[model samples]
Target: MTISLHRSATVLFQGDSITEVGRLVEPDSPLGNGYARKAADRVRSARPDSGITFVNRGVGGDRIADLRARWREDALELRPDVVSVLIGVNDTWRRYCSGSVTSARAFEDDYRAILTQVRDELDAQLILIEPFLVPVRDEQWAWREDLDPRIQTVRRLSQEFGAALLAADGLLNQAARAAGGAEHIAGDGVHPTPLGHTLLAEAWAALAGL
Candidate 1:
């Protein structure tokens, strides 16, 4: 029988700026102000009869290495039934502006390490959110070369880890095509707009089959 969302299920969202969305900084605050909120809203709306708990732990400017640093506290400790992660953009962004260059191989290595630990130590179902870029600016246009592989790694890792995969990037790309261009969904190409958040929630809900 297919499992349905229930009070026993706890969902956690983990990522960088896009996921954080300026949520309540206090540890007391669970869902932040961005796509995390939208995602939570969609889950709640779909399963109003279910009592699943949702938490968002996205931090701005984080990369795979950063996530590796806080894997225990931010994730494993939470003991979620479902865990979702969106990252990688910063791994590329820092290379250009912050002078921190993480090669594709290194990025994948870091990501693998983090997920490996999570799989070994945690009891949650994993959900990998694909990192995306739309090239709103010239600098961002070049980010694809560095970001694509990391995104692909997430896809492969999800299958390897027996996790759910939410195609947030592809959904955004579709929205860009429908609305006009990437700028409409992601103003700066890294951060998403309100519509973009909605699209993310929709895609996530669909993937969750909720």
Candidate 2:
């Protein structure tokens, strides 16, 4: 199930390039032009008096291990009321682009550490987004072998932690089939197009009760 955000909730979105989306590039735009901003903006506009603050600390090229390495500084320090994580795709991308690969076991271990810390140290809620794929090409279909495990891991973790789950994987697949082609969503089969971001943002906002 999803979460109903409170009035003073501070939502922090964490993950890789998909979540980062050039957030650090422009001086005025700290949240970047992606789902994180879109979702937060939706909530902020709907509830102008919410007093809810949203922070984006996502870094490009970060995998589960990378997030683990920096969680204490980026996440724990922020002390957000709600932590939303969107990782694991790069853990599969690296295996195809480079030789680097993160086993599902390592991914789960690192992911668990961060969640455990949050449970123990902070009074916070968790929102875990599934790493999705909309393969435009035939070869990209093979990525399921690497990505499916991680997606399953996130699903399992969400249930284990009783956190709000954003079921992005199946949504994207449905979008790719019903609305438009995969390219209309994620041209590179990884990075999202504007339409893709909007779709994800709408789903996230619904899940977060924003």
> Highest lDDT: which candidate?
2
Instruction: List, residue by residue over 49-68, the lDDT tens digit for candidate 1.
Output: 68888888888889888888
Native-referenced Cα lDDT, model 2:
0.91
**1-210, model 2: which lDDT tens digit per residue?**
778789888999999989988898876878988999999999999999989999999999899998999999999999999999999999998999898989989999999899999999996899999998899889899999999999999999999998889989898888888866999888988888999999999999898665
Task: Give the residue spans of candidate 1 off by over 4 A.
Answer: 1-4, 24-29
Models 1 onward score TM values of 0.91, 0.97
Report, for every candidate in turn, its global Cα lDDT versus the true structure: 0.81, 0.91
Best by TM-score: 2
